[model samples]
Target: MNYVILGAGPAGVTAAETLRSVDSQASITLVGGEPEPPYSRMALPYLIYGKIDEGGTYLRQDPTHYDQQRIRYVTGRCGGIDSRAKELYLSGGEVIPYDKMLIATGANPIMPPIPGAHLEGVETCWTLEDARHILKLAEKGSPVVLVGAGFIGSIILEALYLRGCDITVVELAPRMVARMMDETAGGMLGRWCEAKGVRVLTNTRVTNIESGPEGGPRLSVGLSIGQRAPADLVVMAVGVRSNTGFLVGSGVKTNTGITVDDYLQTTAPDIYAAGDCCEGVDLSTGKPDMLAIQPVAVEHGRIAALNMAGHKHRHRGSLNMNVLDTIGLISSSFGLWQGAQAGQTAKVIDEGGYKYMKLEFEGDKLVGAQCVGMTDHVGMLRGLIQTGFRMGGWKDKLVASPERLREAYISVAQGGAVGGADVAARQHAACRVPWRGERSLAF
Candidate 1:
């Protein structure tokens, strides 16, 4: 068997490795557009902070990991696919044939249609080359203007702040990470950023950007609210779109991304799609979602490899999850933080101490949650929703405390909800706040 994967990201790399593990004799070729070795995009911010070099960002530490696994690495940009011929053509005139193919091209940073968007210093922090340029120019005390306060933008905020750059974030939405967090939770995060000395402009748009004669980043940004903000460096962290342009005429169904079945197989037989470039079902809404998170990307690759290797496997759906840290404050949202229309919700707000939590419930089950300034029991949030644990009488108890989530989970997992006898005592003894100082995770 021969496998050709059209991306060297986490998804593509994992698929290749999985295939190699399943069918050792099969020829696996991992094609990547970037010249660097397979690296993790999640480490880009750390790269900016000088905490790790380019080599540290690589997914594998050993230099010859791919070679050792007999995985051929090809550096070429994919132009298009010949579905009928079962071949992929590269821009440099190379034609590769495969019995099976996985398209995990992932996504690219979306550049807004602003006037000075294509200027020299106006860059999107997506690739290693972008990081190199950003580190080169983003000196200490540089005045930086960020165009979005979304996930990637918020992540870059910490790096920029740590680097001592004056960053003014302009978000069109009323709150930061509006898609991931609700108004209340996102608003708290924005305020937290502002308290850390970062200027946050919400519900604002950059109408125009004026550049200098040399095409430098001396940008004068005109806002929707009629204000001009000077920028030494302009960072466009607006959003990301699927890198599915290469599949334009390839007989693949693509809307926002490549449409696939439960097996991650595309419309064309023997061809599959995975990662950020694929549109799969969202478990939370039971509707199709892009789900461009790293964990989803990795799982997409694994499931695609299984089906490609003739081991039938199905990806039920992907979940919407995000954990963001701004300054010293951490916030997370899982499933659907805004709550379903017919679902009941519960909340606990402590603004003075900057703690907040809003738990969503669909009848007797937990559906979603939004949390800020707290990380304790966050792992349970995804579990509670994913497993559809019947909260029953425990629902009201959870609403009352919210800190007793661990005890509730243990109770539900062990069999059923416990009686009200030792509930308060269990919460006090068992539930230790899960957020252990920046060691929080969300799925």
Candidate 2:
């Protein structure tokens, strides 16, 4: 069998490896748009902070690992897909045919429509090249004006803070990471950033950017209360959009992202989609969501590959889980919060800075949870939610007594709310244990 996987990021690479494990003789061709090998996108901020060298960020396998695994690596951009011919048209005029194709094109940073955005020193931190350029600018003491206050932007703030770069974040929202956290959690993070000497301007918009004194860039930021601020370098971390332009009119259905069934199969037979370019159904809410996180993408790739390899595997979708490590502060959220209004109830326990736990319950069943600060119990709590634990008469007691949360989980598991087929299904959903018997699934 011949398999061609587009985009050599985590999802594509994992799909290739998984396919190899199932059918050792299957010819695999991995095409990457970027010239460099696959690297950790999460570590880009550290590169800017000078915490790790450029070479250290490359998350590649051994030099000859792909060769030994019989995987062909093609470094080029895929212009389009010819579903009728079962071939991928490359920008370099190469046609790669495939019996099975996996589209893991991932996402690209959304650059807002602002004047002088094309100017020098204004960049997006989406790839290693972007990180390298940002790092160079940071080393030269560039004054940065970040456009968003999302997780990536917050991490960049911390990174530049460590590097002593003058950064002014202008977020249009009222608080940082508003989509990921509640106002209370966002407030805590904002305070943390302020303490770290990072100037976070929330409820503000960047109207224009022009050349500053000494030919540097100056950003004209418009605040909600009608104000402006000027700065040098501009880093746009607005958000990301799925990379599915090349699949247009290729018979692959896409709404926000390439829509895949529970089996990860696209509208076209023998073609599958995963990662940031694919939108999966939310298990908790039963709605389609483009949750562009690394862990979810890795799992999508694995599940897609399993079904592609003739294994009866179904993707149970993803929960809205976010875990962020920013400047020694641990913030994590799973399921719904108090204000989400998902027909779910929540109980919040805020104990100063040491710990914060919020449990979201749908009647007697545990639906979701959010934990900020120290998260020693987050793993277990997340597992209980994913397994569909039912608290029944013990819901209030569990919330009242922190010590009994674990016991409540034990009772729910033993009471068959998370047993039998449900346990097997949960195991399948969490089974990142690569079928190839790999020691770890880091990729």
Candidate 3:
């Protein structure tokens, strides 16, 4: 069978490897627009921070890895797709035919329409080339203005901090990470960043940017607050949209992204979609959404590959989740962190300790949760919500003391006809926290 993946990101790479494993003799082609080998955009911040070299961003270490596996890698930008002809068209007029195809083209950063945005000092931290441009300008003590405080912006904020750049974050939302975190949790994160020497201006927008004096800063960033700040560099982390423009006229249905069914199949029978470029089902909402996260993309790739190889696999859908680290502060949200409509919510806030937790429950089952600073046992929130188990009497206890996740998990395990210390031990084993930069242990 001939299999072609129209991306070289995590989803496409994984799909190619999986197809090679499942059907050894099948022809596999992985196409990417970038000239470099398939690399993780997540690592670009680390590259800026000097933690890793450009090669470290690569998905595979060995240059001959793709050749060794017999997976053909093509470097070209996709101009369009001919779904009926089963052909992929590249911008350079090259055509590749495939029996089965997966669209994992991923997303591109959204550059907002602001005056002076096209200035040489303004850049978006989305690609390796962007990182190179940033490295040349974002020097120590340089005044840098970050235009967003979402997940990607927060990460870039930390990297810029490490590089000794004076960063002033301007976010249009009332709080940082507004999409992933609630007001209380987001406020805590903003305070944490401010405490760590980041000048955060929430509910503010970069109204305009312009070339400044030659001897000093090169850019003058005008904010909606009627003030201008001179900046040597400006990084736009506003947001991203799926790269599905090429899918237009291809007979593939798209809404925000390429819409895929539970099987990851597109409108065309042999065409499938995955990763940030596809609108897959969200476990929390039971609706399709463009979840541009790495874990989701990886899983989507594996499942889509299985079904493409004739294994008949159905995706269970990806949970809505975000785990972020701003300087030293850790914040996370799982499932529907934004409280469900008419659902019960439990909040525990400690502004002094830079800690907060909010739990959303529909009846006795955990529907969503958000946490900041208290990272030790929070993995239980994901476990509880994903398992869909009834907490019974433990629900009230959690409402009163949300930190007692270990106890709640144990109670649910024991109530499920399990007994003794064995259940407690398994509960501990099951409730692993998902904090980054720290060992994930049970509470």
For model 3, give the 10-residue run with minimal summed lDDT: 434-443
Best by lDDT: 3
Give me candidate 3's TM-score against the actual structure: 0.93
- Supply the TM-score for candidate 2: 0.89
- The sequence of per-residue lDDT tens digits that candidate 2 reaches over residues 1-443 is 89999988888888888899889888899898898877778778888777887666765648787888899988999888888899999999999998889999999999999887888778899899898777766644557778899988887777877777777788988998888877777888887777776788888888776666665445444445566555656788999999998888899999999999988899998999989999986767778788888877888888888888888677776767888766677888776654345444445556456356667777776777766685665666666666665577677886576546766765565434555676555455446753322223110
Q: Please report how far candidate 2 places residue 138 from its true position, in Å.
A: 1.5
Give the count of colliding residue pairs in each prediction.
2, 0, 0
Off by over 4 Å in 2: 215-227, 338-346, 349-354, 402-404, 410-443
Q: Pick the candidate with the highest TM-score.
A: 3
Report the lDDT of model 2 for residue 280: 81
Instruction: For model 3, name the residue pairs that clash.
Output: none
Worst 10 residues of 1 by lDDT: 434-443
Q: Per-residue CA lDDT of candidate 3, range 84-141, in tens?
A: 8999999999999989999999999999999999999899999999999999999999
lDDT of 2 at 1: 86
**Residue 106, model 3: Cα distance from true site in angstroms:** 0.4
lDDT of 1 by residue, 146-235 (tens): 889998899999989988898899999999998888887787888888988899999999988887436544777788989888777788
List residue ranges in candidate 3 displaced over 4 A. Answer: 413-443
* TM-score of each model, in listed order: 0.92, 0.89, 0.93
